[model samples]
Target: MSDAAPLRIPLRPLARILHAREKGENPDAIERENLRLRHEEMRDRARVRAEGRILVLGAVFTLAFLTIGVKMWMVAESEPAEPRTSFAGAGIVAQRGDIVDRQGRVLATNLDTYALYAHPHQMVEPERAAEELVEIFPDLDQERLLKDFTGSRRFVWIRRKISPEQRQAVHDMGEPGLLFGPREMRLYPNGAIAAHVLGGAGYGEEGVAAAEIKGTAGVERAFDDYLTDPANGGKPLELSLDLTVQAAAEEVLYGGMRLMNAKGATSILMDAHTGEIISLVSLPDFDPNDRPNPPTEGHPDDSPLFNRAVQGVYELGSTLKIFAAAQALDLGIVGTDTMVDIRGPIRWGRHTIKDFHWYGKELSVADIIIKSSNIGTARLAEGIGINLQKQFLANLGLFEATPVELSEAPSGAPLIQKNWSELTTMTVSFGHGMSISPLHLAAAYATIANDGKRVRPTLLRQTGPQDGPQVISAAAARQSQRLLRQVVTEGTASFADIDFYSIAGKTGTADKPKPTGGYYNDKTISTFASMFPAHDPQYVLIVTLDEAVETSGDEPRRTAGWTAVPVAAELVTRIGPLLGLRPEIAPVPLADITLTSN
Candidate 1:
């Protein structure tokens, strides 16, 4: 009813037309219907494609925003960059490797210190600043500093290696000319503990550009390249040293030296089998941290800088009698109980060899060792002859400088007798007419301890068994150990006997030879060379005191038995437990163990 025109087509006619189009009976009507259907299908496909593109655009936008958001979050979580320090003006930036003990304890390291330099022209109040600085550093030469400040000099070193507190103080004072630069100061945490071994580093050529430090002596000099190598990158160079044992030995030796008022002292503790040095102390030691300036007037021959253990050459007195007796026994020249006639002093040229403690007209080799009979021992060496005696000492590594890993060797060649005469053989047997370092004597003793194997002394740790040659038969060494034990149990080195440990050793008291001629009777080099748990020695020690005076004690005496022996006893007592050796309250006597001939 609402239509403008009435519905004209009948349902039957429309249905007829659609049927004809499907059947293609009416050509025009079929083409029009097919065209319309195709157009509608194309429109629907286009709409689907447009919708897919829109979805893709939305995803791209989301991903872009997400990436930006994540980057912002990461930036927020990160730390702020530090302002880079400009070391452009700094002269020196020393970065040396660290030196550590066997246990990784830092022995030597670099400290970040500062050095002060002055630009005289830039200074505001030259006089006032100098006075203030002098007050702050009392050791500074006020006169020299004042002169430097007032002078027209452009650059001058006010101080090298200033402390942090001092730097802050100077900064507070607001000194204009005083500018601080970064520096590395060589620091020794243990002070004078291993001073001789560590030596020291001193500033090399000084200038305004780069500050350099050079190793002048000791291990510092010996291992300079390794320490300063950039590839090492401050990595620790480990040494074969035990701080506790070293400290104990030093304490005992120092105490003894003080008690005896000795000029100087030297002590060494080494592994008997490996020769790895555990401790090497030379008393009157200067602090490597604060090395004393070289003397301008006199030679530093007697200074603390001298490493006496490996450097000092001396006639090692009656201790050499042990070697002489060993030579006699090892060469089948004599046995432990072989009788030696000691009727009187043995005459060889002008020198007459005499024993301080004579036993009798005839004494066995064991009794001669116990009584420290010089005449009897000399006759034993005389029977061995000059060539055999020399060869035996040579085999023990005593005819030359000891193969120790120290710079002391080149400067301290062993003073061997040039003329190996009959007189030389006799005197050398009683520990006279030749000179060697305490290290040489120690190695000889170690040979007697290590089943007759003589290992070279070493400062470096051994990763494997040290290569060495046997100097004497194991039987001879065992016999020698028994003889040495007798000397400690019943003879001159009785003072060195520690109740818990089986200590075996010999004492040497030699007159110090004068620079002008013969020997100084007043001054004696007292030495004690020993091995502990003597039956199977693990450690060997050598202690020496130069020009020691028995100034105090209930019964004061300057002999090795009185001075160096007590030091050895004290050391062995304290360090035995540290070395995992339990105390034996009741020790076995040397006489109980008999040496049967092989």
Candidate 2:
């Protein structure tokens, strides 16, 4: 690969110069010609290099211009598409975490769906399209649809969410103006089952392509950030609710409500050890799939949307009597056999605390609870004093709301007397001066059932017992449990006595008050708070009925003993086995049968 070297000729070589000088007319002329030729050759080489560089630069410029022109032509001639708008910050997250029961059954989940909209200007027949759409969705008004379609507006929303069948119907209409935007909707497959617990979700920050699913109530609202968080990678939120147990409890409660002729009812089944809510039902419940709007007038609680189990606070009547007894015993102010005078009406400054029936002049502390004597309990609580009463109730989570995983919990704060006088204390001892939710009663009873470790109710599943403060000694709780057992056996809650379940509970019947300040004689809030397998309890069940009356007797009766207690008994009989509870059957007598070895 060697190349030949170019010949080197000097512009004014000595041989040429000398020969030219010998034969030429002037030596200067020959030197001038050679120098001129060298200059010309330099100019020609510079022109050739400049031409090459200009060709490369021209090609680059031409290619760039050609590409831009082609892109402009393509965009101009092609059909227009909806422009996608991008924001500067984080976008709306369309996916939400699934809500499942503890057993992994889906309670709430997302469904891939579409939203219907229209470009009014693009429609071939606006009137026809409106008519057809109205037929597809009867809720849509034909006049409104026609007005929007024929109006000057470019776009109109037909429906935020449409089923696949509806989408197909709209597509068959052959209306080019109509369109569907992809969407992910919240779907509760079980309809109304566990509706209050799952709450409901709604659209937020909507767009043509997708919509945000935001929790509106219940646990969905409580755990909104957790459910919609993208970092969790769609891990399901597992609740302690047992789907089978919940369904069973609801059926039994609904039947009981109808049979008892109650206007409304609520039931709560909670774990004694872990404070987990297994099944919380508020009757006259709405499906999360079709959640109703809150009322604007009258009593908002009268609406089906109200969550009575957590948000409805009322005087829980004699159900609260156990707290007075338990606190008195824990403070060493009273014992099981100690006799106390429960004489006539306990009068204090214009208010009188009276018993439902006269027991005697004096009754034992244990009999005070079993017989549910208002005067006896007032006498017992008087020994505990006012400050001690307030502290003990606060310790049992009665001064405030139950911290269950529901957004409505904060609204259920117990109504305590601000001006707590001695009259307030005595009347409250009989469960009249204060109002509390069923959830509060369940938690307090759960504390007693959990041996006074002070369980705070939760809706999440747990692996071990809660680490609550020891509000009272286990000995004191055991004595309270014994008294509650006696209530079911020989007291007002005798209807709750089931041999197999060994139920222990207390009944509460408070007269519903008028809005103007007096109490109605006919209306009562009947409640039964109970725990099963009493010897070694594992759960607490609280059932409350608003304005319930039992007509099974000769005359109509509005008492927890007749209405709420039987409902609780039926609920236990139904869900007991489903909760993996075995009946505590009594052993057969020795003389009745002979045992044979296998």
Candidate 3:
């Protein structure tokens, strides 16, 4: 029974068993499912890993970017800051002190101004900027502006000391790189009236010329240090020169020059008691503001820039007779009663000294001075001896420049070298060989007017009496004054006399030295040195003309009386009233000092 059953094992039973086995789970099917689930898990893990890698990469990139930014900022912070270009925050420009005349008139002053500059690198469009700039400043070259703009240089100057209108116009252009610098500008409002005394200003309104405008030629250059003190920024420089007086002097000098057709002229007025320069004029003067302008040309070939009062040197001719009389009296070599025989010409070795007007008889010392006798002067100088004469001349400042508050070349005195040959002594005695500046002559005359105390001439007003070394005795000075008065009242300086005041002075005409030694026969320098109110002197005035030419009259000869004396008279007459000196009645006894022909 078992064999039959097994064989027939019911194909149904076997099918049922196989179906149960498949439904319950075959091992291989289970395994395959597990493997698929595991594969899916592995794929999920791989996707997570790729996402993590992407996040890491992003973090690394961000860190790198941050490091670079931090480094750049550090470098920027470490660099040095640039220097400031504007002068505003730096400091205010110091103002220079004012310059005024004795009468309180302003002579020099400073004005506020702006200077223009540019930073080329800051300009965005250089060509357009330059064009705009040229429009504002027509003087500026477009090509130059473009070149300057494109240049590597950061800063450059456009213009210095521009006016307010010009500065505003430049600012209105809205130039990006343009800048304005603060500055000051010096101004001389009086123009050329006192140009010789008021020197010019420099860049940045600094005092460079004329020693701080003390007296560049006449007084500015002389008192430069006093006028300009960097520590003090300068104090007010009050001068003895009165503007009204200076103007009057200039007018007279200019008129005289024009009328005489003179090449050049100079005039000076000083207080006899104090040796203060009241008014001084150098003809053909240039405007201090227009210092760049070329000097006036043509004439006796005179240089307007030259200060004849202090710079020019000349033989003073008969004017030396004043000093001769002073020296003779001072040395006790002669007195008013002392007499000297005057012949036609006195022969001294090879040179013969002659007088323009020969007395041909005995003449007193007073007569010699009034007549301006060259022969008489030579005799007096010879009696005084060379050494004594040299000392006298030196004491009178003839050997050196007049010690004023101005720069000056020393007077050309051959006596300084002490080359006293007979001819040299005789020629110097008559003012032929020795040369002195007009300023020197003026100062010497002032000493006589002030009664022999040689006060140093000053352009600055004296706060008190001037202190200086005395050069001559009062008695000698009185005698010299008396002799000088005689000359003006009746001698060569008659033209200098004024009706209101008794004037005393001497006239001089010396032949100009030739280029090849000796003196030119025709060319001459004419001079007049005088003092007003001769009895009690108040002012000393001097006038000089270089190679003046006479344009009128039958005789075209230029003489001291015709060329220089008239200028002196006009200046004294015009300036006296302005200087607080009034016209008064002439004293009776003092008028007795008139020259008389023996």
Candidate 4:
């Protein structure tokens, strides 16, 4: 670098200074003036440098302000959102509680996974990404996926959830646009088991990082708020179902449905006293893990999602007969020994009531029930009078839907005749003229098994009896229990009577009514409402078969005794021990033993 040039200064002629000195005049003023000029030059240079530094600092400040202003504008124009997993201040809940059986077995739970989303503009290989994704999930259409990947969409959802393997597969494609959002999805570990009770869950709120899961039906839907409540601290919702019992029941029911060639079937095993359901099975069933959409074009029953036990109402046939006899006995209008005239075809206008078989001219009230004499039951209903009969049925909870903890419970409200004529009274005595769900029948039978205490059925585990309203005298309930025992031992339900287990119940076979007309002679809804050890009942099981026919005989028998009874017998044989209901009528043999401590 070159050095700065020296500042120009006016110089007095050396001659003049020298001449002044030589004339003996002092030249000190000339020397002092030169020194002052040099000082002035140094001050001017410092001022210019200071001004230059000030200007540079001002430019730097301006640039910083401009950069900040642009950034603020961009941020103001962008959309605002919160992270998906955090909904604390938001009204919606993000996490869901687990559902478990009474035995603490998980029925439904959550799985940590990733949600696949896309930023189309950031894609490096849109076609390859679409091809690979379609390969990973055949359900995806390649063309649609490719279009979505290459289109103007800045963000698009690829899949609601992806397994780790799938996420890795997509990650391997090296596409910058394909991204994963962390989320939890509903998972049913025991596939298709207790499908009806669990109902199902589906996605609610959607985001790239997280998603919301909400119950769509069944207990999941019934307890939606409770399951999602933050105050619950994620405690599992325990149900009345025993997983082992439920699995056994489903297997038996499914096999029975197939063997009987029935269209569908349902079974409910409930605690006679506590009203807690041990196992409720409805088949054909679906896996809640991948729930099917509700059918839009057929009968609701056509859908596997339909909960038959809680939703399907049928003329439960002679299961309703027990209610009449108990009511009559409770009212003191009859005794077990009282004789009832079982005359043929008791006429009531256009319709006539008759027993499935002739019981002669007269049969004792005990025999009336033992033989399942519909005529006798109808006569008892007539004697009970319409108002008292209605009151009695309502007290037994047959008039309303069960208060069971399920979303479908309310829809099971019994179908009652609007007119409720005398004929209606007679038919209803034998489980006709009114339609009720099998669950209702189970509860009614539970009343008898529970010694006449009207119980409100529930899906939650209970510690003891419901101790609901007393609908009938304990004596009447005992008498009814004896009659039901006699039915199994000596009448239509003889097929189910096991000497060791001591089964008791009534057989019901009702002709299915046609959509356009009265009834179909061939198609019948057969049911068996039974309790174990009639002498001292513990549980009431109601098993119903839809259009079941046992064809091993010369003719296709469609009675509950032929179909529902045998299935129930098998179930009792299988699950009775699980319920701690051992078949050994004899007491456990004692053995010699010694006590020791480790």
Candidate 5:
């Protein structure tokens, strides 16, 4: 309204002028619209991009959570591992095997037990704890316990092999530092029944000494390595011993020792065919459970722990005469019908060999064995010569120890070392001056019973073929058996003759030599070596007593017939039925097998 258009213009020019003005005024509006449209387009694209990112993140999180859950489940479903509970105490002894008798009876067994230990550092009121322990275990040393408790030790064994009641009492006390460890203890149930054979146990149920019972004597010492092996825990060891037969033998031996007022006695039974030791008994044996504690002043007689059957050696008198006679016959120097002059004593060097019963004239070999004539034996030995006698004795296993699962001294002295003069030979022929163990006598008689096959004796049950050397000819052994049978039937060992069972045996009574020099006439060793079912022998029994005195009121002198022979007879009577040997009389020989002097 204020300004007037100057010039007269065409319509087109005017419109153009108006359009230019409109374009100038509205330039900001067009730029604002373009900016708003561009902003709206960017917002839509950003929303889609944000939504896509959120979806991708959620998928990734879900996958990772699933993977972790699967892994966790897998880890939780596995099998559980075994707990470790091995022996980790001070000594750490592994468990051992079981010891069983012939009939599978448990002789020795291991029992699980608990031992109490203390961690002294963790203990509260150590002195009080010690006092409490002493109260529960009166035998425990209180002073020692207090000292051990107060000492600077991480661990200390309070007591071992604790009973269940003891363990419960300790736990109820709620004493800190107390710990329990599982242990095994060896136990002998039969007590003293077969103590000598089974032996005893040590602390923690281990085998430890000798007849001293520390794994020192008998089968305990012999089989210690096997019994203690940790790999064979709970396995049983079988012996060839028959407990019934052993009890019978022990009864007889104990009776004889008591009857004769003998210092000590020993007896053994062996299978003649297999050489299995069925029974072995030595009087004055100790209980395996209450083994003597190193021979203190408390125990003096406990020194007899030595096994007499395998360890003791004695001058086995007339019993050896059978071997001498067999030697003469085997060497062809004498026969059953051979005759020898036995008028009086025969003098050789400083020693004079005398006959107990002097036959005024000549006597046959059969008469010699029946009468137990010393002069007749000397005559026969003289004919055989010393070398031949020595050789024959060696073959009979007299020169060496009988092979058994035991420690023993060898039989017979060194023949070469002993002065072998004519007097030595003569006296030895009648079973004097030469010494051997009871086991040796048993083995030799077994040879006679087995028809000359000298099978070695064994404690272990035989599982394989025989491995012993033959010793004598069948004919020679038969002759010896015949003579021995006659000795029991009509000679000195008549007491050993059983009514139902044919008996073959020899009687021996010799003076035990004094430590100084000659034999002690007052002290005598009596022995009886025997076999049953004489015609077909099965078992051999030997009984021996040292320093026997006759108190039976029958005989003043302690002879084999009175002491050892009676014991052998009793043993045979009791054990025969147990061994399945029927009491039937053996038939007489087809030919009269008699012994003759040489």
Candidate 6:
């Protein structure tokens, strides 16, 4: 094969020979054979070129698939991203709108927690599980828990709110019955700071998969519809309360209550201009976070659950004299200089009105307020008469429910005798026969302080100028302020006088009515109703103690000046600076001020 030489055809001769074969005409045989060889070579070259193109396309496809696979591997190896959630979706905490103070401090809010549950039917070694649980939570009754664990129930609450540690312990127990799920719990961040004002939220029906909380009392109950509505739940509810003022008032009031060995106490601080409640303290307040169950037996009426500020109605004692004097002044029946003979007790049809301390002196209208004279006040009330006194009390909101933003507020129509006897007029004038809520008295004082404007007391923050109707002439209100100032400088409420703050207030010590149908001379409701910065009159604060008893070795005095006045004074001292009040004691002029009886 190496010795034989192959012959190649020339271009023109090979082409012609191929054309002759196609026509079936015979030509040179050598050229025809060469042409056939050339044509075979060309077909082979074309086949090789087609194979090269297909191999290149396959390589490109392979590269693309390899890149895609590498990307998928990278994604799988990385940590998975968290899934987004919404309130409307399950497993998300759904709660009421937040309750915040005027400064945006959260008063009431929701806390996300785990609710422990169990499936007794699925439990294995339930005795062991109950034993372990009781070890974790000593409060859980072992016997009761053992019963729940061994029962055939599908689901049972082990605990409402459990810590992460407790949950891990339960999970580690390897018990099939133990389980935990998401829950929303209403939390009062300040604990019992404003418990009575914020109230509390209660859980929905038992055995419900989804837990819902509804407001039960106080502002929570009052604004439940707005708070629970999905559209409004995101927006916070703002209140007029100042936590600093509230804390101060509570500290002083509670101190006084305990020191006096009193039954209960209530204190209120309100803005004179807008009637916004700055602070309201009712002692023995329940913790809104964990409200106690109602007592099984005994009198529910004696329960601390009652809000003494607005829900309680009391005689309010000589505090009502402030209103009586104001009414007298407004009606032009008595001027500050007008004199009244209070040396003798005024005898009515079935009763006699006498001052607690008879000085046998004639008292002016200012002196009547300064001395808190029941006899003088009764004489003035007699002049105003029953109808005018009724109208005056009505205007002051004593004849109706306080329009405060509380659902539990009392609709206390003043406890009045329907007969409207002369004796009733005398007693009512000195805050004896008629009973009214402390809030009613506070609102009335706020009216006098706000230049005779009748303001509707509000818990919501005020945004605009209050459109309160003018209840008395500004001139008369000014005169009333002067007399009120004298009450602190030279009158009965000297103990409440903060020299720097120019405090003006009234002291009231009323005999508490016995449940057995008579007044208790030994027990009394001592109260102080006051306004600070007397000349400008910005805030009205009222402190009341139920059944205050004096233990001071000097005397067993159950009077407001001895108990409530000092409380008010201390509260003002603490909160005045917080409220931006400067203390500059300018001595009140005493040129014509006198309280001598004829």
- Per-prediction TM-score: 0.80, 0.88, 0.75, 0.83, 0.74, 0.80
Residue 212 CA error for candidate 2 (Å)? Answer: 0.5
* Order of the predicted models by lDDT, top scorer first: 2, 4, 1, 6, 5, 3
Q: What are the lDDT figures for the candidates, one per model?
A: 0.84, 0.91, 0.76, 0.88, 0.77, 0.83
- Those runs of model 6 whose alpha carbons end farther than 4 Å from true positions after fitting are 1-93, 206-209, 299-301, 411-414, 585-598
Q: Candidate 2 at residue 12, lDDT?
A: 73
Once all C-alphas are superposed, what RMSD does model 2 give against the true structure? 8.5
* Candidate 2 residue lDDT tens string, 362-445: 999989989889999888778988888998889999998788889999999999989997777888887889999999999999
Model 3 alpha-carbon miss at residue 380, Å: 0.9
Please list the residue runs of candidate 5 whose C-alpha ends up more than 4 Å from where it truly belongs after superposition: 1-93, 116-180, 203-214, 229-235, 294-302, 408-417, 463-467, 515-517, 585-598
Candidate 4, run of 10 with poorest lDDT: 82-91
Candidate 6 per-residue lDDT, tens place, 385-500, comes to 98988877777777778878887775444566678877788888888888887888899988888888887788999886476888887878888888888888897788877656
RMSD of each: 13.5, 8.5, 16.8, 10.6, 13.9, 11.9
Model 1 over residues 352-389: C-alpha lDDT tens digits?
A: 77778657798999988888888888889878997888
**Candidate closest to the true structure, highest TM-score:** 2
lDDT of 2: 0.91
Q: Model 4 segments beyond 4 Å from truth?
A: 1-92, 586-598
lDDT-superior candidate, 2 or 3:
2
Tens digit of per-residue lDDT, candidate 5, span 1-598? 4596554333234455567577775444545665677688779989999999999999999999999999999879976553322345423344556777677777777777777888899988888888889888899998998888888778787776688899999998788888887766666776665666665666633221101113555666667666665555447778778877777778778887988888888898888878888888877787775676546554232365656787677788999888888877777777888888987677765667787765667877877987899998888888888887777778877777667776433422323336777777778788886788888889889988888887677776666535456677789889999999999888999998777777899999998776678888688989999998888888888999988887758657788988888778888888889989888866789687787799
Per-residue accuracy of model 3 over 1-598 as CA lDDT, tens digit each: 7556333122234455577587894545544655677688779989999999999999999999999999999988895653332345443233456678997898987777777888888877788878987887899999998999899889878886688988888788787888887766667889898887775655532221111122334444554445455544456788888898888888888888888777788888888777788887877788876575435665323556666777777788888877878878887878898999777587766667787765878789988888888888888888877777777878877877676665544432223444667667767887877777888888888888888887667887877655556777889998888888888878878887787767888889999887568887878999988887888888888899888877678878678988888778877777777767778775679567887798
User: Which residue window of length 10 is worst by lDDT in model 1?
Assistant: 82-91
